[model samples]
Target: MAETITIEPITRIEGHGKITIILDDDGQVSDARFHVTQFRGFEKLCEGRPYYEMPAITERICGICPVSHALASGKACDAILGVHPPEAASLLRRLLNCGEFIQSHALSFFYLSSPDLFLGMDADPAKRNITGIIEAYPEMARDGIRLRKIGQQIIEMISGKRIHASWVVPGGVNAPLDAGHRQTMLQMIPEALEIIIRTLALFKKTLDQHREEIRTFANFPTYFMGMVDEEGNLEHVSGRLRIIDAKGHIVADAIDPADYREYIAEAVEPWSYLKFPYYKPLGFPAGIYRVGPAARLNVCNGCGTALADQEWAEFREIERGPLMSSFFNHYARLIEILFCIETMQGLLAEPAILAARVRAVAQPNFPEGVGCVEAPRGTLIHHYRVDEDGLMTWANLIVATGHNTMAMSRGVLQVAKRFITGAKITEGALNRVEALIRAFDPCLSCSTHALGQAPFTIRFMKTDGTILGET
Candidate 1:
């Protein structure tokens, strides 16, 4: 008789997380937990640093979404400096943001989540990884890898290195965009566009095959949130916030990012270190909403890129304008990739992109500042209070992954009940649990929570019918 089930260090994901299902005396799933086993003390380490260094320092939060951190921190630094970045700098910042969205989203769908989608969820546990994906579809594998490389290449070409910290700083970019680099990047745009379009097309075909699965897979409704442009176009940076209900009614619109704290509040969950962020109007558990690709796609009007705009419309048609399924989050990631390539192409045509004046000189002037930008994973916010001489006094970061904590727990419980039963635990049952977590494409490594293996076994006290311990 099987007593416990554990999924340790789930594969093809960035960080460490585990889920255990304990069976009871009657062989029922007695308890379920999705625990994040890591810690990152960025708040403590950030103290005492000058505000000007925040952009680079905070960018280290997540290698996957560093651009989001850089942008948020840079914006906070801009607020601290009390100067608006030049139009050219704003354009470059948006361009870099597109690169981040493309790479991070690609990593989420193509690398982490696709394994279960492409190979059946019940596919051999050992072969159900990227390696399994490579053997099954070599070109698709190459596409995801090469496509991610293009995004990193853009970041490197612009910032002087991959994951280059400090390229963004108070008031403006530390390194200006060079004419030659833009030209080089411009040359690659056509190829990049083709790659994105083709990959998206292929993904659509896969989605078509899995339409039933996509619809019913994880169809639970969620309150959607994201920063949208003033005109309601999907905003990755510098826009008013919008929150919409599952049925597509605009619950809140044109909300400024600065007033974010007022509209959103964090809630603690006993099972996970990650905090759940929800809309204030609805209150705690009931207000539990979702952020990231699923939330962004649901609330945004369009991607603002020509080709991606067309694909975005088609995506909307599939869901009759807004998709809420956590599964389609994969589709949303691809759509954004299409948008990023298109956005990058549009930026290249602008003379300012190739212009010399990317940075404006300025000095920090504020005692407190807040920075926010949509990371590929979700909306990332960084707030800091600085002393007159610019010594950091406090740090508060609301990571994209943290925003999904509520939804993730819900997803875990939902999946556990669906696949886990009185029968003995199997690798497939365990994969379903991990697969549910991957659906969020969570970035726990980048979030406040750290990443480490804590292999655990959950056993039941069958005779007394008491839940025992984490062994």
Candidate 2:
């Protein structure tokens, strides 16, 4: 008999999901799938709204990466208006994004993932949480909290609210960075940098303990994708898209964000709501690519910032080719936090960042536009088409999490084959399976938003499609 093991509602992720590990008739792990069970209809809901309302509306996608959506949407609207924001507006936007990167990466590293990395994977489920980590490592926990708070403070200082702040507009930001607030944020930088540096040093010392995971955990060859400057420096707010293969050779470079639809396409799977995106030239599954911290680091020549550039060099030294191990996403994420702080400090020191002319006046001049950005998770693209009256006719959003959906599914299978036994699945093995998903740091809520028929139940069927069971 072919049996299947199902783990429902994978915990510690942004939204609800389930994993099904399929077994062969011989009781050996055959394959696995990651399913996003929820349906979010953001694209369909925004159809009749004005294009100008997109920034505020799309920001509701995920509480964690709302700023990513807001900025991308704003950029798309900027295209529609045929106007460019003032330099100060662009600087402020980058500063806000840096804050987002710091807070979000810190949350993933400390609150969600530290328990598994610091404590044993087999630790009691109830005890493997932020509270547990706090109890075990009080000072470290406090540092993480303080670091996250500093990022949130930066966001609030510029945008006026921590979440869903409509500060970014079509052509630019609604306000400039206040002098007093800028000084306050500048003061917070050194402490934040110290926290990340200390945490990174401590994490580096533990690499020896996770040698097995480092070697086997989703450590496969896949093309990497992210934005990069013209000089191939790491960029978060704006840049051209770059895709590189497993051997560190650039497959595509200087690709325009406006032409994304020509290069990228989404593949729908019957088992999950999330769509799989692939490079169009390579066709469907073969075009699979990984994004986020690891991918960004792999695709970029340098981080452009001084301290981060030094860390980037060290990160690349771990592998002659691109770093393929998902386990290193943790390290990549911390280094990004360091980069975020350094970049934020540099932006604040610029006098032009305080200029009062933040926004440009414009009316909708284009019928269609596309906007792209490096969300904390990965590459995020927003596309929109408007009617003559400037009302949106259609919208498409490719979130960072969706870009990595194909890779995450494969990661589950790889981990299952390594850790799970069909005869008996232990808690430790199950934890490792879930850990693989966490390694990708996917945002299910952001990935699953589309209009479609949603299947609420998952069927456990044989390879030949005979139904074994459903949940």
Candidate 3:
């Protein structure tokens, strides 16, 4: 007889996801399927819109990372217009991207995944949440919330609105950077840095405290991909593509970011609608790769900034460098927080950040283009085709969450085997399984707003299709 276990409507993560475990006749782990449930038609609905409308239109896909979509879409517009924005425009774009990184990572690390880490994975499920987190570690919770507020402040300060679709227009950002606005952001950076330092210290202590748990918690290796600076330093907003194997070896190093079409091949598994993307060097299933902060750390040689560089060295010294487990991904995110704030500090030092040439005037003429940026969640790619009149003909988006679909499914099985037992399910076991998935901090809207469970009935059957055993 075959046995099956299902983990449904996974908690603490954005959108939805489910895990189905199928056991063979011998009852050994045989198969696991991660299902994404809802269907979103954003890609389908955007057809025939003017290219300029894409920045605002695509921003609606996910409230979590709208600037990501806008930048991606706007890069396509820059190509269509045959002009890159002025230096100040580019700097302003980087400014907004750092804001996205800060806020989104804060939500993932502190709001969603922190409950399990800080509260203990085995703690009562109903109580193991942000609320519970506040009750238990009020100061830590406050720091996290404050960090997210700073990110929101940066976004609002620059884009003129806090969340979901601020103005990052075609040639550049809609508004110039004001001295007062710069000073406001400058004032906030020191506080944000302090938050990151405190959080990094806490995460380091937690790593030592939960040594055994961290090792066993969804530990597996796969290909890693992300953008990195020329010297192979981690690059969140812009850089070249770096792909590395599980052993911390750069299998494909320094590939042009825009030329990712040459190395990426998308595969559709019969079990779900989300497509699995793999390294072209290796075949599907075999080439299953991961992308995100964890993947970014794994692929990059260093973080380039000071404190983050120190953490990077310390991170590598951890028996294993570049952390393969989902547990350390949380810490890697904190390291990124350190890097983003440091990088912002550097960018602000440049007087060009306050320049008035924020938007450039250009004639729309080109036919197509591709834009690449690393969203807080992972690497995001947006490619658009347009007509001579700047009307979008077609669009393709590779969101950060989509890059982790394979790993998410792989992680589902790993966690199910460890937590989902055959005995009457306890909330502890179910919460553990969900906690395992939330480590990915997936945004289904970026991939597709989808994930849920369907009751499955399996029975023994003969060759002629006659049922031999039924429940």
lDDT, candidates in the order shown: 0.75, 0.86, 0.77
Which digits, one per residue and each the tens of the lDDT, describe model 3 over residues 1-471?
A: 878777677677787666667766665555666666666766656778888788888788788889888887777678777788989888888888888889989999999988878888778778888999899999999999999999988989888888765588888878888789889898999999999999888888777666645665557777789999888888865578888877778888777656877888776654443466778877655676888887888888888889899998888787575577876778888988889898888888889988888787787777777778888888888778877666677877888877787676656656666655555456766676677677778887677722222221222333233545432
* TM per candidate: 0.91, 0.94, 0.91
Per-residue C-alpha lDDT of model 1 across residues 1-471, encoded as one tens digit per residue? 545666777666667777766677667776666666777788878899988777888777777888888899988888877888887888889888887877787778778877888887778978888888899989878888888888888898888777855688787776678888888888878877787788777777777666544654456776788888877887788887788987888999988677788889876545433355778877765676788776887898877767777887888888764576677887788887877787788887788765567776776677878888888878888888988888899988888877777666656655676667775666776776777677778887776433222222222222222434323
Q: Compare the candidates by TM-score and give the number of the best one.
A: 2
TM-score of 1: 0.91
- Over 95-201, each residue of candidate 2 has an lDDT whose tens digit, in order, gives 99999999999888898888889876889998898999999988889988998889888999999999999888899998988999999999999899899999998
The superposed Cα distance between candidate 2 and the true structure at residue 261, in angstroms, equals: 1.7
- Give the best candidate by lDDT: 2
Scored against the true structure, residue 389 in model 1 reaches a CA lDDT of 88
